[model samples]
Target: MSRKSETSGDRRPAQADALTLTGRQAARVAKRRRVMMLGLRGIPNVQGGVEKHVEMLSSRLTGHGWEVEVVGRRRYLPVSGPHLWNGVRVSPLWAPRMMALEAIIHTFLGICFAAMRRPDVLHIHAVGPALLVPLARLMRLNVVVTHHGYDYDRQKWGAFAKKMLRTGERMGMRLAHGRIAISREIAETMGERYRVPVAFVPNGVAVSHCDVETGVLGEFGLTRRRYILLAARLVPEKRQIDLIKAYAKLGNTGFNLVLAGGAEFESAYEDEVRALASRVPGVVLTGFQTGDRLAELFANAALFVLPSSHEGMPIALLEAMAHGLPVLASDIVANRQLDLPAGDYFPLGDIDALASAISEKTATSLDEQEVLAQTERVESAYSWSSVALKTLDVYRAVTK
Candidate 1:
């Protein structure tokens, strides 16, 4: 019930002495919770996967009796001090970028902030933030760098930018005290390419938040009768256009296609997708819908599809399943390991096959028992409390 807001924050230099819970310790007794500073693109649900992950994780961890902090961009917050939110200590640090590219600025502030206020453990979510490893090591802080994905896979990074990200990833993994990979695919990539041992912890979802309603279909010439959901950024690897072309081949105008999520970069790719939509019917673009709105779009759908070429445990697909919409995702290793039915699997980048699969599943709906089974599985496996515990284990291993 009582609190201290560091509004400021992680170095893995030393581990704190573990404390035991006493019956008379007062149920509300605020013990010494680890000072954890999580690295993210931004915080407090800033319209991205990392932000959403942190927001949900903070609430669940705090509920589990951990003093949580949700730090994010300073520009979004009114005050420049540490503020408390839902029982977590949140320190939002801000700095002006002084470079042609924002990566240098992002990396600089992450390291500088971690250096100033050393946390019991530092969990860096963004690859850009992983560049802080040396600084964290210098501070003797236990660093747990999470490899989000191959950031340089394809976006608009020059040769130098790509090299820096790859080099940074390689170096950060080696320098950090512990490593966390969101998916086994990424973990293996780390070991094979970077030679770092990583713990696999997939992203979590809020089941309660899965309940949703949406007008995306009506707004974009789609009918509620039936449709497929493909929520992802309009980037190359996401392969949204591939879905568009495949939908054209299947030519299921009765069942519309809803493409949520905005363009990260690669404006050309987005423009191309839009152009294809102009020629093709039944393709609706709902730009960046999240929270309840995102839930509604997935909830009302006949089937959800993710035609991505690469992924590191996409929460989007998990959210779709939570909505009880049987998924028809790319047959990537990540999707395969999700332990879903074989009927849900589809070939990656094969538009005709993906579209045909969507049409075949449009008439089928998940049974109530199956929905409950999937929902319960997601709740236990990817719950924030569970994720936080796994994360703490990694921290404990490093500090010990």
Candidate 2:
């Protein structure tokens, strides 16, 4: 009788232990559904491709039953911005506002903060911040690195900075549990060089839902479909000077060439661009614009040109395409992947070719059918919902 009683007591404890173990397992599953995003400066009206990407992806992830926390830089985010935007938690970490050191320093601090949060996946964006992937991995965090572009190839980086970027690429490829390349071209390039399989997840564009504010157009003295638009950061690799020169060559084209991007950092290139723009007759520098202002600009443009020397799937070009605007992009490998018609692609650095193409495109009437087809293609292939699902797949793969 004593043996039977003892056995019953043992079974009771065993049953309790089983229930406790089940609860712990369930908690782990819950934790695995949470993510920590890093590397982008900040979000919500920020003038950056990566920030836009993070904002869209994070907002969409939550709807699919994933909890997301984005680490933002205090300097970049507005003072009035809330701790939460669209259900994604925002944690701002203080960092110096210097150009070269900001990303690395902020990413280091972000990784430390993420470690404490114990998110299932630590998703790092851009190669600059991927420098600390090894460190994050060492902390036993599941790391997923997204390669935005070949930063080392940018004209602004010095030799040491270039080397650091290359090193970061190496470390990120080797250390991270998974990798995402924003374009097929980027994915193929990285895979060939590093011998690591990467998931190709291109950047997405949202169809503008805002009404075209004609008042904003009047504020800039612009007419509907009578202006050429190039909206991107006023940086060297974007080659705004090249566009300025091309526009200057096409004097009296009747279409005002508008450069609608803000200076990224104080530099000789920006000074040179402004100097060139000053010399040009028809070129307009509208600085940085967003929201309805930017949408109206895109909606009513005669033609959109992206003559960047380099790109990782240019978001500005995608935005123009999303708006059903006729796009003329340089024949850079990334841009070529868009499969624009032969007429739409001008040879890189060919000022005469760009000027001529601009003149020709402006004079010719846009094929509404072609524009509709392009918009359909862009929306179908590069929807944020699709990007979010693919990114979530990467996160789940890494965590599992």
- Least accurate 10 contiguous residues by lDDT in model 1: 10-19
lDDT by residue (tens digit), candidate 2, 223-341:
88999999998888999988889988877867888999887569898889889988888788999888888888898898999999878878889989988888899999989988888
Candidate with the greatest TM-score versus the true structure: 2
Off by over 4 Å in 1: 1-31, 34-39, 74-82, 95-100, 188-196, 209-225, 264-266
RMSD of each: 6.5, 5.2
lDDT scores of the candidates, listed in order: 0.71, 0.87
Query: How much is the lDDT of residue 154 in candidate 1?
Result: 53
lDDT of 1: 0.71
- Candidate 2 runs further than 4 Å off: 1-32, 80-82, 212-214
- Per-residue lDDT of model 1, residues 1-400, tens digit only: 1123212123222211112445456444545455455555455545566777777766777665666555565654555678777677777666454322444565566566766766667777756667667877887777778777777665556688778777768767888888888887888878887676888877887754544345644566655537888888777778888888888887645787888888644467788888998888878888887666776677677878887877767888888887677888888777786877887888877777876787778767778898899888877777777787877678778767
Model 2: pairs clashing at backbone N, Cα or C within 3 Å = none
